[model samples]
Target: MLRNWQEVLDLLAIIVKIPAALIMKVEPPHIKVCLSSHSHGNPYEEHEMAALGTGLYCETVMATRAPLLVPDALADPHWRNNPDVKLGMISHLGLPLVWPDQNIFGTICVLDGRENHYSPPFLQLIQQFRGIVERVLKQIYYDEVRVHEEAAIRADDAKRVRLEFAAIRDREQKALQAIKESKQRWHFALEGAGDGVWDWDMARNTVFYSKRCLELPGFPEHKSLVDFAEWERCPHPDDAATVLAEVQACLDGCIPAFANEHRVQAGGGWKWLLTRGMVVGRDDAGRPLRMTGTYSDPQAGRSRLAGTERPPGRTGRHADGGIAARHGTDRRHGKDGLAGPPGGRCGPRIEHAGGQYHPVIVEPEGSHRGYLRARRRQAADGQRAGRIPAQRQGRL
Candidate 1:
């Protein structure tokens, strides 16, 4: 931990009793002193640079990738002309510093003014210090690499979270938009039809009546009806049983639709209502979940045909594919449909047949004068045959 390069060099200078000790770093075509000793008469300074290819001790050690020793540079012919000898540094010894990849880093070396020989202990001490410097360089490299890798991982995670959040937000927006559009369409349909609408939640036995529905029965628009029992009370007593029975048949799956003509008590008098509805929702068990329907008044059109009539014995279909003569033909009978007595009310009645209710609008009757005269003659013949008394014959 106490591996400061200058401190190591200073301690080395004292232990070896040398005038100069340093760590030099190699830059292409030049070498610089990175750390220098603080010993007295030490001529070298830290960060000093000199050209390579010169006869400098550190440069030669780096070039050879081995240790260099000159006990007395002035006396050795090979080192006699070395630049350091002219500067009064005649003794030199150094070991080359190599990186992990075998590239030369520089040299750790010492110089002396007097002639000296570096012993084994002095050489080993400098080698151990070199190992410490290399370890520090390796640690620095590893820490820098790890910092970059962790930063990249954090950036990737942030990007993924942003994408997922955007996708979820898009889906939520689309769902809300769809619900808004559906509600708008529903309201538009209700406004245009002008029919009294009702929704019944069959599972809860609760009903929700629209403003039109409440108004149709001469009730205030602000009144809320939540119970089916209350709705049952609104219909005329004579028609309530028939209406409920038809509705029940639909709920029980015996009929495809609930359709019936009934009367309800209004503010003025009884109002005829043509009620049509069907089960709109179902559960997994095939039970009814919800039902919806509309209330319409057919009297507006029926009033237009008040005085219409048909010719005698002329039975044919109306434009609506049912008998046109309402006063005479009873479709419940076979062909050659029996005509009711003249002036009798003969509107189609709602009846359950073949698992559903159907309307059979009948043809109107002939002239009342002809039908009544024929009826009286038939009663006289019955009295003459003694099948009826004279008093009963008079009533007929």
Candidate 2:
């Protein structure tokens, strides 16, 4: 009986351009759709009826035994993927077509390619058709041709819900994949710059220092690295005070957040490092949450510059005494200070390299700003000594 009802509704809905609508029977143990615009195209064999399962959402309306109208499939949390929806049909209107005894015989439905909130024309059409379908169903009941349509409606509802769930799961999987690829791309770009990066988690008080950052500090082999405390212990005492002061000023928001070039004495030799940073972002309430920065070693520039625009390497003989060893390698990890590499090559001498360390040490044209020069070197006895090298008396 439901099969025959479905056959009529399906043909009518298609001919009228109303998307999949259902005529359901509101009875106990069923309350399903007897005929559906979808089921109309297919044979209503018992196996086929069972197979329809919950393939559509109209059965849901029937199961609830209420006249439901879903205007926009895309906007509706329910029926978002109804076949009519997948077919680009959007508006839906369903009126319960009941029998003479107030028993819901089925529903008169209409669908549109565009969304609607049930207009006057649609309401009038529903009233007319429901009156017709209901009267026909009552006559059939008297004829004993009435088929229970409640089961069909419930089955369609179940299917619609399943399809909606599948769509959600597929969307989430795609999002996760995109996120994974984005992170990989981010890391690749960060590593390619040869800049050492570090992040300070304020709440955790934990330091996240990249391997490149450690390398920039000349402590690439450090078994462990901590925050400011551990790092300050290795900074040249004289430079430590100024470096810490500048860092504090920036972090405290007292100064405009910015980058500064400073020399850090590592392994007894002072290496030029460019430190860049900013309070670019903040958490809610605008409190500082995390700080990120990068450091780059510019010693390579010194070697590279010497070969480029400079007078020929002129060895300077100090008028004082001992030979001012221009070739020097200082590797100081605080505790041991500066350790020489086998040969007792002292630190960089002023006379050989020829320039003051202030402003730009190598570039004579670089701004002669208020920059200071503090050099760290190892003496002949291998003891690390910190001093403002005697007025460019030494050579590079």
Candidate 3:
């Protein structure tokens, strides 16, 4: 019935078309059939375990790696006294259940109601049945290996999601919890998140802004990031149109999420940044009413092109011994009186859009940065920030 050894064993028993079939494998104490399609065969004791020993059917099949067919179980003097016949089996056909490795580990058998049922056609039928048994054996082995692989994958992905949720959930407290937690734990995510963390409430028609967010051109402070056109305010002219389009899609009640990483002005030149905001809460109609995510600079990612640090921006060490960004726009005040590359302003290497990573960039003010969207602080009612995070500190 099925190419699966587990299923084929049970199917062979009552194939009314074929008197009886049994599927048995080796263990230790006795020859026990795992699956039987009809009541004509033996079902071993609950605690019984099978073994490949002196048992005729099992031993012969295991030793010769072939099928044993006897059309008349009672008349054959060679096997008449055999336990199988003594047990009242009148006729029987046994096919070795061989694995892909050519190991005869079990048997698929059919018992007949009459003598001499082992005709050419019936023998051929048993041979055909053997084909199914062999394949099912192979599949059983394959399924075991496949199961291991799938379990490994599930474990790895679950670990990643678990960590991500842990981080995101950290934002439950202090309005600035996301910033404090990142600095304390990852310390490098700021470099990957790009700049200007923001929150948009589609239903309330309000958007929350941060200091660095105000620095990005497309949106103004204490006011809507859009006024007939939000694109004009975006520092990166190239990405403005797409950003606006994504914004509308996120707010249209069609899609409850939006995320984009593109270049934007940071006091001077364009720098890469990752912005992620998802609907933290939704309405009855499945519409997104609120969203929140982090925004940080990604200078370190830009520096590690091809694992070769390209000397860009300017070279001045932070008081904490971090390199001053040599490229891109960095408007943050530095101890050396130079604007270092803005932290978290570099996007992911190439087009790798999704991944949680943090690169250590120490700021003079005692903060580190990287890219990661961990859990937000647990709101008394379970909510996120009412304002954006503070600017990058030391370890740049």
**Model 1 misplaced regions, further than 4 Å:** 1-4, 27-30, 51-55, 75-86, 99-104, 158-396
> After TM-score superposition, what is the CA distance of residue 106 in candidate 1 from its true location, in Å?
3.3
- How displaced is residue 233 in candidate 2, in Å? 3.5
lDDT tens digits, residue span 88-187, model 1: 9999888887776677778888999999988999989888988888787667656877898888888888888899889989988898898879855764
Extract clashing residue pairs from model 1: 324-363, 325-362, 325-363, 325-364, 326-363, 326-364, 327-364
Q: How far off is residue 155 in model 1, in Å?
A: 4.1
Comparison by TM-score, 2 against 3, better one? 3
Rank ordering of all candidates by TM-score, starting from the highest: 1, 3, 2
| Best by the lDDT measure | 1
Candidate 2, residues 126-220, lDDT tens digits: the string is 57767767667778776553334655666788888899899999999988989878855754566567777766665554456677777765675
Instruction: Identify the superior model by lDDT, candidate 1 or candidate 3.
Output: 1
Q: TM per model?
A: 0.41, 0.33, 0.34
Q: RMSD to native for every prediction?
A: 16.6, 23.1, 24.1
- Clashes (N, CA, C under 3 Å) per candidate: 7, 31, 67
Residue 150 lDDT (model 2): 59
| Candidate with more favorable, higher TM-score: 1 or 3 | 1
- What would the per-residue lDDT of candidate 3 be over residues 295-386, giving only the tens digit for each residue? 55445344121112223442222212212222222223333344333332321111111221112222222121211111123334366534
CA lDDT of every candidate? 0.66, 0.50, 0.50
Candidate number with greatest TM-score = 1
